[model samples]
Target: MGNHDELICAFLLSGDKPGRELSWQEVQDWTPDQGNIWVHFDCTHPGTGDWLRAESSIAPYVLEGLLADETRPRCDSYDEGALIILRGVNLNPDARPEDMVSIRVWADSSRVITTRLRRLMAVDDIRNQMPTGKGPATPGQFLAKLAGRLIDRMGPVIDTLSDQTSELEEALIGSEEESNLEDMRHKLNELRRVAIALRRYISPQKEALRRLNHLDEDWMEEEVQGPMLEVVDRITRINEELEEIRERASVIQDELANRLAQRMGGTMYLLTLVATIIMPLSFVTGLLGINVGGIPGSENPWAFAIVCAMMAAVGIGMFMLFKKMKWLTIPK
Candidate 1:
């Protein structure tokens, strides 16, 4: 939409009936007698800021927050309403869930205004259900349902991370093959990045939900408290689970590093053993091959065979000594 058409969608809800769409003109003329109103806008649109400044009665700080390009999850309560910020997994095609999408909402007893940079599936879900009379009937229900929806979508993403981490842990235990560790390292890094990113938002999101649940507004009804608490609890669990996943990724990384070091140590030990045994043999061969006629092997072919046999015996003796010294075997 353009600046002149800033609204993405508007809804008018009645406790006695289902919600219906409201046009820009209707939204501008909406009165408390018309039941609750929800106006969703694409904040990036050219005229969105102008419309909010000129039409909405929201506080200056909340207005600035809603129009801002970036915001963290938070809730600021005001006498008129509360400016609440929340985030949901970026479920859009090609977008990573770690790059969460923010949904800024200003809500009170009778009106709600939400803005976003990208489409949120949770918002769509509520919009779709409103026609079926299954949507929130009041401003409090709206906030609670929106919070619930945002948290519900997060469950699957968190579960996926946990499941993948568990599988990696199993793989680490079963085998530490070089190629497998390489691939595991890549996946573990990605998982750690995702977990950290998610925890960054989810932690504040839980607090935001709690604040919304306890908002001082009359519209924040007692019935909404239960669902809001549930949302907060779920977000809290997601944060804790993300931390676990991150720790597991760290363990996987350490184990992989240890395995690589062990392999390298074994290879180095074998190379060192070969060099140790060959050093004396090479010295003897070089000394005998000297151009000086005093060299004993120069005149007798049997002398060459004797030297070869002696060198072989020396190599075997060195090998046995190394085995007995336990240098040939990897340390426990």
Candidate 2:
């Protein structure tokens, strides 16, 4: 492999060495006659855009795509080459896997140029294969291998999402406590959000690959189409799995919400019954406490005891009446 810091990675594919790394100066001096070459670049490099436009002689539209700040999964082809944008799950440290990383590629018969703002391990995978004769030998093979790598990495991430969804569903099923349902609800929503984001990119990327595979460009050899189509089918399956995760999450979240609502309603029902029982007692105490001389209990020495006894009876009576009517009982 070439110096990653210097040229990102530039390799010449020739029969003698199979794949040979090239320096920055060597890449600048490279020609079609030298050999079919693959170059991977960190688009953030200060000289990348300039070198692409000037020395590399990349067309304006193609250069724009290679250096664009934002892109979605897509494919476009001209007479000479095809430009493709594909997204892979973000597996970088401290990064959420749903926040996918994008790779931009331009490939023809003689050259294949790939760019990325973030590190795509799939590129590293391709470079690793270079030493072996098993590495990509043509532009079509390069696209196929890189695409296969990106989709392959998505498999574990999609599986994890499905597993989490299943766990949450099981937790909800066996649970009797409403105490942690709120927290479970939050977790469920987060899972749904991640599934949606992954599906958004994967669905479109499947279409992008399908479009690229069907293009009439000479660069896309017949043998490479098999791998490209495999990539399309893999992404489509990933998309379907994500959609299933979202649907399952939604159902679990709704169940959690219903359980919480039932608990809240039960609490409110008890509070209402207590308030009803206290209302009449409050009115009696307030009326008797008035300072008017016509108050009946004010002159009696035992009036305080009698009033307390009477108030207790009233409270007891109310409770009995509520029980008889089943108003104090919680419904199933």
Instruction: State the TM-score for model 1.
Output: 0.92
lDDT for each residue of candidate 2 in 27-130, tens digit (9 for 90 to 100): 88889998799988889886678678887777898889999989999999887788999998898899999999999999888999988999877888888778
Judged by lDDT against the true structure, how good is candidate 2? 0.85
lDDT of 1 by residue, 1-332 (tens): 22455789998865446779887778878998878888899988878898888888777877989989988999998878889999999999999988999999998888889999999999999998887788888889998889989988999999999999999989988875678878888888888889989999999888888887778778888888888888878888888888888888888889888987888887887888889999999999888877876887577879978989999999999989988988787532
True lDDT of residue 61, candidate 1: 75
Off by over 4 Å in 2: 1-6, 14-18
State candidate 2's TM-score.
Answer: 0.94
lDDT of 1: 0.87
Positional deviation of 86 in candidate 2, in angstroms? 0.8
Q: What are the C-alpha RMSDs, in order, of all predicted structures?
A: 2.2, 2.1
Q: Estimate each model's TM-score.
A: 0.92, 0.94
Record all residue pairs in model 1 with backbone atoms less than 3 Å apart, i.e. clashing: 3-47
Q: Give residue 93's lDDT in candidate 1 (0 to 100).
A: 95
